[model samples]
Target: MSRQIIKDFVYYFSKPLPFNLLRKLTGENFIFPFYHLVADNTPIHIKNLYPAISVEHFKNDLEFLLKNYHPATINDVLAFVENGKKSEKPLFFLSFDDGMRECYDVIFPILKQKGLQSAFFINPAFVDNKTLFYKHKISLIIEALKVTKENFLVSELMVFLDIFSANNKQIIETISRFKYSDTSKIDKIGKILKIDFESYLKKEKPYLTLSQVLEMQDNGFIIGSHSNDHPKFREISEFEMQNQLGQSFNYLNKNIHPQILSFAFPFSDINVPFSFFQFLDTKIKIELSFGTSGIKKDVLPKHIHRVPMEDNLKNATRIIRSEYAYFLLKSIFRKNTINRQ
Candidate 1:
């Protein structure tokens, strides 16, 4: 079975165990739960990518975390990591990626009502709806294909993707697999499908604007860089990786001027080298860096592994319990902590 399938099976079985019991067994008192966005209606840019949690589900997630884990601020997390600060209850730090408009429109208000703080990581390229992420462009093209009935266009798309015999589903699967390196192909697909991503950006205002980011910062929410543009760090060279971080950090310092320097890897931190963390510590002076490696410890003291709360649209209860269960399972094989090379 695939690793995900095994995780799902474990999650299914683990859900019946009480969360507190699972938590105690895992001996974990700190968690960083993160999401891309939250909305009642799925936006076209994100619909094909992953299911954005509904406002109601997000509220439930908050309620559960607040009940079981103390909501922690960025400073709290820093203290815990640096000084081994302990709380009576375990701590949970909330954060959102992608700087989606829903963060300003829907999410922040809800967080405010409950007196919670979170970090919002954004790509400098996509800020103020100036451009769309390439992945989001792929999503828009896929959505277009679903609604387009043009036979000639479909045939052209299949030819472009080099799968002339592909069915509609096959074509979408191909498009969905397009990586950051496939930007040219994604652009061509958008052209062929007549899906203008710029128009969508202008019309939808999908990402948070500079003004919105400023307001969010003023409201006690921390802001950080995801990158200059969201790219899979594993695919890029060391130089390109450093450039990405440098450019985004420059932008954040010049424009946002956040109190603390922080980052979350755009896609993940898998295969990232130990040297990179050293660079971040010495050159960037980043206060914190995060990865979506779920319920694990990292060898680098400053790097944190955050739980992705949106797995298969599961709630906090199931996801957290499953993470703990999976952590224990991995522990038996001595694979729980992340050791960078």
Candidate 2:
């Protein structure tokens, strides 16, 4: 119920990105720069609950993220795949999937200064123009539905599930079973509760503005597609997949930049097929495709693995030095074979 537990809960729940069984498997540990990376901005919803993050620390983390972690480009991934030659630098890709406004103020400058490279996988639906998305639309509905005098209300979270009245257990179970790199359930629940994704961005104080993208690109960072309309790859159909992936391409290329070299499978996980990536990788210049699982190699000439950092902890530094992190990764290094497979 307290903040500490919530923090512990986030750390415990969010694993594999930072720690895993791989240490037991290979005895070689890889530093995951993407795993449990701290975001620059404070989400309006969670700001009140946690302590203020030092903007200085955030900046420093960004610097470390770029220098200590991150791949040179998609070519790095391709190299790992083809040559199996381990790039001396640990394979870390600095990625901010949602394209938050903070990327402009907090992250971009640091990247630009270091002459470092990272990818920005954005949802074009929420670009400069505000558009209604299912998640935001639902939030709008539920927000209005509630009768509250305080600025924010803490409902049983379960109550929110009851709104759809469509088998909360099944839906929650469906959702709980899902594990991916981004905030899938949050966006999905937002859509479910009639929160308009784009409009909600407008309503919220902070979001990635289109100008941010132009600036980041001008600074030498790569831009990529998140999705047109964010959809769970496991739940959606092939036509849906095409449309979803296509929308990411259509909007990003049309509105942001057509030459986007990458595509991040929204909530990519165990259920989704590798074939979903086939078309995008083969035809389009999408040389990079990001997902959570199944990546165990070094930076190659193609795509690479990223550790999905979340907001479950109060102390950001703990992510790199937590017991779980030490055990999971230390075990990896002990093994003779670096499973940069």
Task: Name the best candidate (by lDDT).
Answer: 1
Write one digit per residue (lDDT tens) for candidate 2, span 106-195. 667766676657777777775664553343333343443343333222233445444344433344343444333235555655554544
CA-lDDT, candidates in order: 0.88, 0.52
Question: Model 1: per-residue lDDT, tens digit, 154-215?
Answer: 99888787897778899999888889889988988888888888788999999999999999
TM-score of each: 0.96, 0.63
The candidate maximizing TM-score is 1
How many backbone overlaps does candidate 1 show?
A: 0
In angstroms, the error of model 2 at 66 is 6.7
Query: What root-mean-square deviation over C-alphas does model 2 reach?
Result: 7.9
Error of 2 at 136 (Å): 5.6
For model 2, what is the error of residue 54's alpha carbon versus the real structure, in angstroms, after optimal superposition?
A: 5.0
Candidate 2, residue 249: lDDT: 79
